[model samples]
Target: RKMSALAGRDNDYIFRQLLEYTSFTYTYILADPESKEAILIDPVIEMVNRDIKIIEDMGLNLKYAINTHVHADHVTGTGEIKKKIPSCKSMISKYSNAKADVQLSEGDKIKFGKFELEVRSTPGHTDGCLTYVWHQKNMAFTGDAILIRGCGRTDFQQGNSGRLYDSVHNQIFSLPPNFTLYPAHDYTGQTSTTVEEEKKLNPRLTKTKEEFIKIMKELNLPYPKQIDRAVPANMVCGMFELQDAKK
Candidate 1:
């Protein structure tokens, strides 16, 4: 979709942008038209400059840099954004054990301008995964918890197949069917999917809890390419100052 079409002025004052990075990871920029206040979800460090340019060009006042979870695939841009935009705070789930300006819990609302995102604690992917829902917009930022036709791998990082199944069924599938679900990563060129479609079509979620566990256990997916470096860096909000200093 066109960047301009990604966000626009409306009666509800919602401004949004969906950006894609090399890892098939998606970053979201949401703003309130009236206050011009914005928040970015799941930003990648490699795209920090690009994200900053968009915010500056749009005349937006970024208030928060939020992560859906402590990602294992890529480092976050939260620290870099905070360095560039001092007013913006970095936020992550309290269960993540990651350092950030704000440690959020379930039911916490993240406000930017007039928009408020209700935090739904949907762990089991990594124990700190969260889904941010905007009831008015009928949208949910699902991260890796629930992908297009699949769910996150429950092989490592405190992953539990049973808990993930429960989380999806109870926390996410419980939402309105029309709710548009935006996942953090999509490798097959797919952009978005609706809760209704996922509920009915998601291969991983459609199975019984026992079957799901069996499937997840047998998949044997490969580890992320950057997990070693990414996990450590992300724990500190992608601040590589010490690593850079070593060079």
Candidate 2:
């Protein structure tokens, strides 16, 4: 199965890793030895066991499980993982429309181990969306807010082109050109992309704001069949409500 293969890759990628997981949607785990602290970002719930094993195997303690927003595609495994590692905190952006142990805003910094992640509110794909920037790696994780070759669609709940444009051009694109982008979704089948590459080659990016809006309206795609199920599950951090396992 696709999920199985992804799990294997995820584990293999973490040997000397700086907090990375690659389930259906990649879950990032960054740990620092001096602080004995670790943080999980935008993780898929199905890989909870793999993540936990990795955490314990390394003797690092988890401190945070952060979601960029209420997801429409994948379920967050944060809550389930939290139960496993009681000390870990759950975080999300205030705009996420979900309950959070910690609600972050743009420029908010979370310190753990040797890294500090600065939250950037990038709300084009979803109103409550967020992006995390690691100054050490010069890498940014844009959760569903932006993708390689494409960006998050603005056709669903609280979505709008005007806002998407503002979020992308003013907030996300403003970052330095060389920064590598690790998007929540990997539709491109590539490992990752850089800010400069997206700015130049993303078809949507090449158009003027007005043109981009028109194109999006004209190319309205079908609703995701799994959104109804995914959203509520994601809202609560991927816990099944007793009957979820049956589906």
Candidate 3:
């Protein structure tokens, strides 16, 4: 699906989207219009063809495929995308224990043409989660750290409610109020929200840190169906072994 193209701070770059239906995941395409240098964020393995087609059609030079975290619901398309586009490098958090060409850390800057994204380590939903902020554009890609009305569950994958609370309040909420916040997943069909809106209106975030911890402790949410298959595959950068055809 085609989402709106958001111009950068100086209108020199564009942000495109490719939403995956099954996982409710949002893959972003950030590109510099002048140089046509582009990077993709959180790509889904199943949608590699569509993503490649889009990149090819736009005549953009794919530079990198970056993942916000090692997702439990869907396998990443980073490895496959790199195979298709040899020039594209795959990136992930240094703490994720996942294999990637580039392992990023906090304060690492990813540059594409004239635009740059600052990586902020925001571990909560997972210990490796990283939020990418486009400072000049006043925008952030919050990978499961702070959602629209809620946040990621602190029930698995090294999740810690207390850490999550601090990450949001200190790392994210501290940003300029008007900064646009784009999450990795939004099941309700809501596209985007602002940092101010999330700080003031997010039900989960409005509570005190202690209260938030209690709430997360009692969530008892069911495990994701794909966790068993996805986690292992994601660890190796989404390389899964298939059964023999003649079995």
Per-prediction TM-score: 0.93, 0.85, 0.92
lDDT of 3 by residue, 70-126 (tens): 999899998788778988988999989888889999999999988899999999889
TM-score of predicted structure 3: 0.92
Ranking 2 against 3 by lDDT, winner: 3
**Residues forming the 10-long window of minimal summed lDDT in candidate 3:** 1-10
Q: Report clash pairs, candidate 2.
A: 19-29, 19-30, 45-77, 95-128, 96-128
lDDT of 2 by residue, 132-222 (tens): 9886767888877668887777899777877787787877788899988887777546657888998999898668999988877877698
lDDT of 2 at 237: 68
lDDT of 1 by residue, 160-222 (tens): 999999999999999999999999999998889999999899998999999999999999898
Cα deviation at 104, candidate 1, in Å, is 0.7
Q: What Cα-based lDDT does every candidate model obtain? A: 0.88, 0.75, 0.88
Worst 10 residues of 1 by lDDT: 1-10
Q: After superposition, how far is residue 63 of candidate 2 from its true place, in Å?
A: 0.8
Per-residue lDDT, model 1, residue 221, is 92
lDDT of 3 at 208: 98
lDDT over C-alpha atoms for residue 109 of model 3? 99
Pairing residues by index, what is the TM-score of model 1? 0.93
